[model samples]
Target chain A: MKILIFIFLFLIGPLTFGQEALNIIFQPKFETENLVINKTYLFKTDTLKINSFKCYITNLKYYKNDSLVHVSRKRAHLIDATDSSTYYISEHKFFRFDELRFNIGVDSLTNVSGVYEGDLDPSKGMYWTWQSGYINFKLDGTSSRCPGRKNKFYWHIGGYLPPFNTLRKVSLKLNKSHPRQIYIQLNKLFEEIDVSEVYNVMSPSDKAIRISNKLQLLFKQVP
Target chain B: MKKTKLLFTLSIFALLSFDIIKNTYFFNPPQYFPQPTYDFQKNPLDSNKIELGRLLFYDPLLSANNSVSCASCHSPFNAFAHTDHDLSHGIFDSIGNRNAPALFNLAWQKSFMWDGAVNHLDMQALAPITHPSEMGSTINDVIEKLNASEEYKTLFFIAFQDSIINTSKILKSLSQFQLTLVSASAKYDQVMLGKDVFSDQEKNGHQLFKKNCAICHTEPLFSNFKFETNALPVDPSLNDLGRYSITQNPEDKNKFKVPSLRNLSYTYPYMHDGRFATLKEAIDHYTSNIENSDRLSPALKLPIKLTSNEKVDLIAFLLTLNDKEFVFNKKHQFKKISIETKE
Candidate 1:
């Protein structure tokens, strides 16, 4: 009887103590509808087909009662909407998080801090070869609204420098009474996007900053 | 027994001190120069790492085709500046958009590239290594290539203690080698140190430089490293907007980083585009051919009225900035290692 009790306690102890993994699920959406890559989606009056969508989510922080409680061990993560593996955050400690905060791009320190492994690796194709600095947000696709060659629009937004710093801060208040997953609505981002005028923003420019501002309104708590 | 214990302690102390000295690499800049902006404490320089970087810099294996190396464009004999071509020629004889600037006194520079595109020295090599026209290879490709080589594996083990060839180690080691390229042994530096004196023409030219050029090309470093439009007309073909391309501000249009005046003789074809092949032409442009523009440097707005003799005197003074010791330093040369023997 004593041995059985000890075994039961040991089995439950590991589960009770810091073993619950907090999962943050990122679901790409277009307003009320689900977003599927390579499929034509009617956005406003123009038809658009997103071939790829990737962005670096960095400096994740968790808060309880408006006070900072937990922080992610990983400094940065490259999330691909197409890959479900890239959308979940399971490495962080379990916390009854009331609010979550993160940046949309790599910070200035990380930009100049040589190279890093994992998502920050240069092999990720998110890094600029002509200049230094990671592309904070990359949105590439073909839009009928675009007047450029092949009707293709590519927006690679990033700049860590002053006056043109494109790193955006996103804070979402989690409804503890509801589900834990955070849904990143892609429709809200494209609502204000005019593909024709600002199609090819490959570098840190005024257009990149403008697009980055639109990207800031992409997160919301989902039930 | 007490004496033996004291001796043991002293020996241990000596060994510890030796270890400390070995780890702390010092940057021996001239007394007149400002403190370096690079925080060496973050990535402490080690001799092994520098050796690895030197090998990497000379090795063309970093390129996709293994045909172009950093030294191909930045030759040590030419003060690390490519002089044969106006624009840098890279893999497959592809011409680059800008001239390859001389590599020296990099520890003091706030930014890299003429347009200040690269923010850090460690990040500078990525631009060339991955550029389509340059080395034309990714960082991962370079690492894989280096990892496969037995010589590099040994070198990496020696340098980083871990034989794993990662981007951090590669970039940091490259920086360690470049940070050591100091060009402070010129006649100008000697004059500053009171070790030598300039001739009459050189002296006159120095005074003129102080009055006219010293605002942008500041003393000691020979540059403030700020972006300025030196009145050169924009080449319609290249259409290089300089700083404006990075910042997208109309105010920054045509503004290029002020280059150092050191090694002026070896690093010919001056300016960002390498439009001027000779110092005389550069001087002539400054004196006569400064096209008026809204974004032109305020200092150059007023015409630089210099007589032909004054130009000659200025050129003579500029020549004093040349450092043959730096250009000919065998320490910066390619190490003649027999890969066959090592293999």
Candidate 2:
């Protein structure tokens, strides 16, 4: 009985302490295969090609039974299509979590505060230079359906002021037993709007706000 | 124990020396001035950072073709305001819409630019840097160039402890230099400080200014820094709707920020578009040419009826506001930076 008790104590000690990393993979797919920059894809019989895609993700948090369990130390993350390590979040040890919560863009308070470093820096190509604001979500591409010079289409969405604030919060329930992976599906995003009509969104306007609200639907925790 | 004691004495000396250096570059505005709005805690002034900012300010490499710089329009000799040219000339002889305003006493300004578009001083440089007709360059390209340069690499490492050139450090360094541009040594300031007395003509002009212009262009700072319509007829070609373009409010149409009266002698031609070439013309517009429009500020509805004599006296008082010491300050002048073209 003494030997059994010693074995039990050793097994339980390993479970209680240390750190864990969560892989929040943002997978942008073009139909079946993964999305590649400047690669042509069939868009319901129309030819489509994406040149650039980027967005800011912030306010990462985790919850268990509606109680806050973890929060991210990173102020903001600029998730560029070319950079795979941008969205992966590593957190301190937590026993259990039922919900995955985060924002699709930087908050209004952070926007007006001033400048930033690292991923939030203006040199990241996500910040607007003329007026003060960050380009919260950017998607530039070329499609046969798009009507423009060289068949180009760009949607640079961002705003912090009221009536046009584009920041979005996404809270998704998780199965405690499975690995955490957030998938951002491009096919679902394409279905939401026609690329021809809503192509040029470069500033803070009603269209930018509407598209930002629609972005919450693009993220999910399921397979 | 003797070695430890010696180390402690050396550390104390180092701290004292650093304190003196910091004070030299410190944002020390006059006691009469209001508290500065800049959050110094965010980016504290360091001698190295200010020097880096000065270098960046004069570097033509900031422009797209490496031909124009911030000093191209905001020359130091004219109180950092471009003289002769009413409309600012940008890269490749491209003309900008508005006159480049003088840069001084910026620490007290709550917002920047003629339309108050920029909420912070740190972000103000972005406008000129990226404007197509101005610098015609993007912030990313500028940083890439700076990162590639050997001179900037060394300067940046000295300014910021780490050598990584980022936007936060860049803007913070620029603000540190600009915040030190305190124009508080004018003859007007001397009179206020009781060191000197105003001339009889200036004394009368001071009284006239108090009665007519005091409401909008307030004292000490010389501007209330609020948006007000002075009722200038819109140019048919430009039709610039000043503050309304930023806010999109009907009430703000044709309303530009009330400029500071200090350095009025240096910053010209006056108004948002540099329409008036002389002080007399600017004053005359207020007294006689104000359009009877509802958009006009209540003070401008009556627009002070200054006699020709009063106008002369007011000009005398305005000239006293110029601080010659500031415009000629060697510290603010250009120190040429040599750069290697990124291979």
The numbered model that scores best in TM-score is 2
**Which candidate's lDDT is highest?**
1
What is the DockQ for all candidates, taken in turn? 0.49, 0.66
**Weakest ten-residue segment in model 1 chain B by summed lDDT:** B15-24
Q: What is the i-RMS of every prediction?
A: 1.7, 1.1
Candidate 1 ranges with C-alpha deviation above 4 Å: A1-19, A29-49, A112-114, A143-148, A177-179, A194-198, B1-26, B338-343
Clash count list over all predictions:
0, 0
Candidate 1 lDDT tens digits, A1-223: 9999999999989778848787777777767666678989887788888888898989988888899988888889888877878888775456677888999999998998766778997778888867788999988898898998999999899888877689999988877665367777876766777788889998887888899888778877776
* DockQ of structure 2: 0.66
**Candidate 2 lDDT over residue span B245-332, tens digit each:** 7776788899999888787777888998999999999999888888878788988777588889999999999888999888888989
lDDT of each residue in B10-66, candidate 1, tens digit only:
654554455433433435888899988887877787677777788889989989999
Model 1, C-alpha of A172: deviation from truth (Å) = 1.2
lDDT of 2 at A138: 90
